[model samples]
Target chain A: MRKTLTTIIALALVAGGVAACGNSDSGGDGKIVLGFSQVGAESGWRTANTKSIQDSAKEAGITLKFSDAQQKQENQIKAIRTFIQQKVDVIAFSPVVESGWDTVLKEAKAKKIPVILTDRAIDSKDTSLYKTFLGSDFVEEGRRSAQWLVKATEGSTDPVTIVELQGTTGSAPAIDRKEGFAEVIKADPKFQIIASQTGDFTRAKGKEVMQAFLKAHKDIDVLYAHNDDMALGAIQAIEEAGLKPGTDIKIISVDGVKDAFVAMTEGKINVVVECNPLLGPQLMDIVKKVVDGQETPQRIVTEEGVFTADQAAAALPNRKY
Target chain B: MITWTRHRLFWPVMLLVLLLLSNLFFTPDFFSIQMKQGHLYGSLIDILHFGAPLILVSLGMTLVIATGGIDLSVGAVVSISGALACWTISQQSDQGSLGVVVMAVALSLGVTALLGAWNGLLVAGAGIQPIIATLILMVAGRGVAQLITDGQIITVNSSPYKVIGGGYLATLPFSILLVAIVVAATALLTRRTALGLLLESVGGNAEASRLVGIRSRGLIAMTYIVAGLCAGVAGLMISSNVSSADGNNAGLWIELDAILAVVIGGTSLLGGRFSLTGTVIGALIIQTLSTTIYTIGVPPETTLVVKAIVVMIVCLAQSPSFRAKVFRRPGFAPPAARPGEPGPDAAPAGPADPTETKAEVPA
Candidate 1:
């Protein structure tokens, strides 16, 4: 193990040394060089978010120095510091997690590079660290999901048992979505959560947690999944148990992904609250506005909505984000 | 009699029982069972289904561990092989040819095997640490997988491909059958062949094995090859189940789960003794624990804390000190102690007990 560690370190150093060779042509004519550190491709949403940022940068003719942090905070910090060293015009990143980033953002701020957050938000109390945050209103999404569920089961006396599939623990979305949903559902004392688990925003975990919930709870009316992947996973578990998913246990999840819409249209999923990931155009607009000395809001929320099965069928053909 | 109690599986079994008992009390309807499509469908079944993949990986992991090595790249290999299979099936030119499909399968397995060999050579031949050797592939293999699919999700429309991962045999998932086959094959190979003995000898003392003319390098390389093959099979199961080849998400964090399964199943990461059955059971236990957490209405975020606590408890239970304390308690007798034998606490202070000393020695 020790030998492997040394070799890995040596290789990493060599790789890092070689990487420094590619930055000499950073457009010497004072171009707007933006360092965009992306979260790793952990999901379809993340992959799409990355493409949006890259495409927007290309379209805007910005010098985007991009790095894929591969979901590691340390890798992201290293990339950000490298960007600072290179003296980019602006720095931006969609952090994998919210904490452990104040120090890196501070460095970028000290270097005079305004940082913009995309997709996910940071947990820092000091809002001045990043220039602006542009993303979906996750809390609103949760509320919308809950509101739809309330409407779906308006007069049904069958007790509504919620089995929530949360995202990664401590993540901004997971924290906010749970809070927001709880706020909306707290009004009804009958609405009880029988099982809640962090599916870690992955399909496999979602299925695993849901299976456990099935064992622990004899009756389940609703599954509120934080993301489409988990909901889809829950759908599989639901079906595997010989119970009709949509009829037996209604699923209302966030992330208006294409698959979510498909599930809804097929009547397997009851509702989907859209969390627009194609903030590419909006993000680029904000970046241009911020760089051009125009005042911007601290929070820029993308337009979002809820889709039922009927709406899902109507929107499936045209829904892009 | 004490030797039987000190057997490695004893601790893991105790943990399984403790978890089951805890779930029985703390969780509502914990023992509830359901029948779906004429087969048992409940939390237990769900655990088996969910853990089947990890069990397969850990089965391979056991061999790698027994060879005094680790394969951090198994997860990456799974991703690559899954991506490769999806990419091949998605190829429009030879869409329906069985021969072409077979060739693609062979090629994907070949690539993974080559990667395993590379890791094996680095560790066994170049003397690189197994972790570091496999870590290289772990990081770089994802890039290669992504490159293969051009960072696109390659959706497979092939029936055979889907059947390989998502189909059922006699009401059981084909993936589970695949796992069963792999587990049974591995057991047979190890217990019924010289390979197991050679692996144990090599892991116990590589220098001694070399002195005795055992080709430890070849055995090490074969272990990796076997692991790569298992990963290839796992990749097929995952990709087909999803009907898509997602290079980024496929098999992500699987290595951690595989390692956790191996550890939980009573396999020492440092290598030597291994049990495929124990590993499978460990995988089931992990899945069941997660299932239990979700079943009882525990908040998902709390699962992290729950998993951490459970793992810590299991580790503590394995400690000799903890066992000794437990046995010393009133109404609790050491299972192996004779009627007149001194209780653990009553033993005179002397040279450290060989069993305790050996337990303290890090594998």
Candidate 2:
């Protein structure tokens, strides 16, 4: 009899664990509960982004429902459905990729829950789907890296042979950054892209690709990597090839990671363009503005800065991410 | 056709050397190496070092393909094993301890072996198609890795773990040593024993072998387990090299490369007649080509096309029909219609049957 009773209790606990818990909020407590479907803790930047949002939500006394999609669009859609069911006042998500969110966005709209796009944008043509987009312009980030390269090699009449290590192919940043960089460098006939390849935005690939570039090109003057990790990897490659990275190959990259800053201080990297991943406080502010019926712009751009060796030295200690 | 070219390693070795020589035109110092802080540091060294993972994966793949079975889950297993090792190491109070890292390696290998056993059960016991059985894990293993990592790129800074991939022993990459050990062990296990012949027999004709005395099921299961063990070690190498477990990208599309390496090594997909040396050379050939691409200034966007074209040429050169058609003399004949035959069409001969004339397609 006792064994049967114990078995029944165990069965009940397992059953309870499987079911989704419903929110008990009726909005009478004067707190706006926000449901956020994140694009998972993909990188250090993403982890910091999540932290900022959660911390900001707590500061504003808003009940935040957080869900990590682990970089899957399907998971994001499921999380959105759960948010709609919970009747949260606001929903925000950083999409894993553009497109394929029309159905879920329409359902959220039907439920009268405003959706926000943070960090990344969606491809839905219907402008009414998202309340606003708040993120860095990746194209502009690319242009900044190119602009720095052009200035650093301004007076030289000699051709600047460049090798580009792109991020994941077909990603928004990879495509837009290539475009923006190409647009800025096209006018200058001396800045020739000798080689360009996708490193898949990982350290090992970056290292491997950079090793190849070093072997292929004896006169490569500029190395433009898509992200800090790739640049860091190239630094190792360049060093192993017995060439000074900052001197022999002027390294320019995006994403102001802490390691990038260290690399700059070590004379391995020349320039780093920032694409700020920390958007929590601003995200929370917009949520409040939306709640108070204040006018919020259709798009908001984060304030970001470019870092050189001197700038990296000053900012490395204070940089949150 | 000459007997020399018929040897499996002939074309692959020639292609590798040709590719390496091509490097000299772009980078004059392609073959130069220098000692740096008691370690070998050069592009050639880097090829052997970075190529270690591919070498290991394709080594296991060669055996699997020899059994007439494919394991699509090797890439996924690589991710899972790396994730497990990194996760376990990170949880320890001392990440750099020899005992902890050893335990982590054991734990990761153990789990992946079980996964291999699971695949073996499906293919050998349940009689499921090997491709489909491995494909199930191929799709689901990444999710399992993501769960273990909590959807984060788990980075561990253990010095002992660092030694596995990045450290040097006797002025050579520690990774190269690991590769050598694994390759040597695999060669010895097969060549020095009866296992190699047994595998060939089973793969060459499973039903016939079963009718005889061979336990084909046990042998098939053993191959999958070995493949899992190989992928597990590769995972450790990759994660240790980067000091991180990236669930999504850890071993992405590596299975395709391994299969390619196995095919390039002169292993027929129809099974039987495996070559460990040929597979090693094939893996090196691939590594050299990739390294040469960067050194030769191939455009990044078209790199894949360039590689595909070169691989095609090498494969085409090895094709017997192509050789017979192109290399045939003006008076060439098909071995004089076999001396015992009364006429050209007296009876069905080797590969002369139209139905048996299927081109060997490597998957």
Q: Which candidate is the best by DockQ?
A: 1
TM-score of chain A of 1: 0.92
- After TM-score superposition, what is the CA distance of residue B24 in candidate 2 from its true location, in Å? 5.0
Model 1 per-residue lDDT tens digits across residues B1-363: 655566556777877777777776766556666567866665555566666767777777888998779899988899899889888878857566676667677888898888888888888888878998899899899999988977766665676666677667777777888788778777777777777778878888888898999998888888888888888888877776766777877788788878887877766676766667668767777766766666655665466788888877876666556666776787865454557656663552211243342342122
TM-score of 1: 0.88
The digit string of per-residue lDDT tens for model 2 on B1-363 reads 543544446677888888888888888888988776667767789789888988999998888888889999999999999999999999999999999999999999999999989999989887778998899999999889988987667778798987787677899989899999999998878877778778888888888888899999999999999999989989899888877787877888899988888887777887876778778888888888888877776766678899999999877765546655774567665554557756533432322232221222111
Report the CAPRI category for model 1: medium
- Interface C-alpha root-mean-square deviation, candidates in order: 2.4, 2.9
lDDT string for model 2 (A60-105, tens) is 8998999888667899999999899888889999987777989999
Q: Model 1, DockQ value?
A: 0.54
